[model samples]
Target: MHAPSQNREFLGVGWRFPLQVTPNGRIAQARHEQRIEEAIVIILSTAPGERPMLPEFGCGIHNTLFAPNDSRTIALVVHQVRQALTRYEARIDVLDVHAENNLDAPNLLLIRINYRVRETNAIGNLVYPFYIREGR
Candidate 1:
């Protein structure tokens, strides 16, 4: 196998989100692009003040958890996501952020994020599902 480039090394590796342990007794790690993607998910999933040491280090979208599934709410979510990623993930340049309603699951909001890896210029996208209403 080829060796990872310096840029890829700069991307860094970290323990996988949810903190899984491998069979060999080591923490599962996410590398390079996968690491960046996981970081994005973590940022979006966490709310400000959720991390005691880093009180302001998360997306503000969680504040709208009970917001109506309407255009105004969607716009706010998009803005929050863009702002959060821009602030936290210095490795990426956010290209676009948009949200769509899940017709079959009315309470679900599907958020799509398009970004470019700054070091390698690689393009990536991730879809994060946000639940606006609790299921019955």
Candidate 2:
């Protein structure tokens, strides 16, 4: 008897869509980085203690979202982002996290992150926008 040759499995990072199902009622799946990106987005958006089971989980930046856009606020965000990623995400090595107040929209912020994918050793960046004190 011979063993079947198989490659590494990647079920993705998040939920599945357009679930695979046929007359036989079998499940279908996909593999890619979109899942990982989605997972990171979710992790970044979730507030700490929002997860009943894991009270310490999440970036917890929502609490400071209303803070004025200033050097202090930016520093807080950088600290929080680094803390959250360091605690939650083990897939990538975070290189840098920066926040820039929008020039045209003072109540907005642009956060940039530089990271290196651990498994493939690929470098990538993530830009997340934050709306501060909206409609104020």
Candidate 3:
């Protein structure tokens, strides 16, 4: 099951991952810090796989320095997160960002971004593995 939408609103400081959003006013985020940590331990325990999806970044995992609001950062974090979901090989949606400022405190800036994931049908006959299996 996917993460709950309400968790997304919280300020994700630690090892939280923002997922999708529901039809209502809820947001989705994941708290897989422990699981990811364990995965890292296992990955490091081995001599590394031939074709590892994630590369080592000192501690043992890849892309661990990504932040929501960083200089020279624009949709890169969301893109990386979406790319990792290719296991389902679904089509990823564009990230939408909206910056809003309070009228009382006009200087205070607040950014609200939404990154949605969608699944689309694959093209070509490769979708069907069976060739000619008929018993009629």
Candidate 4:
């Protein structure tokens, strides 16, 4: 995978999402990110001193069609998440999302997506850890 976008900052992050999937494209990732974004928006919109937390979000993987050796689905998910995060003026870092087992449902997968406000400073030696979870 490519280096995590430099615009986003990582301050130690992790996440958990329900392991559930249907025939349609996986919704856990999308739903998880959406909820996180909503939560951040709600918090940031509050009155001064009312904001409960800084921008942050996470999720877990459920029934997936990818394996540890398969990078296609994983890559697509990363790209999708990256694009989605951009809408929130944020980015995902240290993302680790996948199923623990390769042959079944109800897998306990965890995703640690670090969220941060986008930065304009594009000049610097920056390195972000973009971790990807897989079947193991």
Q: Which of the two, 2 or 4, has more TM-score? A: 2
TM-score computed on alpha carbons, candidate 3: 0.23
Per-residue lDDT over 1-136 for candidate 3, one digit per residue giving the tens place of the 0 to 100 score: 6555434323223432324565785664343332232332333233223346644211211332332233233244334323333322223233443333345553332433333433221121111011111122
Q: TM-scores for all candidates? A: 0.91, 0.76, 0.23, 0.27
- In model 1, the worst 10-residue window by lDDT is 1-10
Model 3 CA deviation exceeding 4 Å by range: 1-14, 17-92, 118-136
Winner on lDDT (2 vs 3): 2
lDDT of 1 by residue, 1-136 (tens): 5543454888989998879999999999989999999999999999999999999999999998888888899999999999999999999999999999877997889999999998888899999999997423
Candidate 3 clashing pairs?
Answer: 5-27
On lDDT, who's better, 2 or 4?
2
Better of 1 and 3 by TM-score: 1
**What's the lDDT for residue 99 in model 2?**
89
User: lDDT for each of the candidates?
Assistant: 0.92, 0.72, 0.31, 0.35
Ranking by TM-score: 1, 2, 4, 3
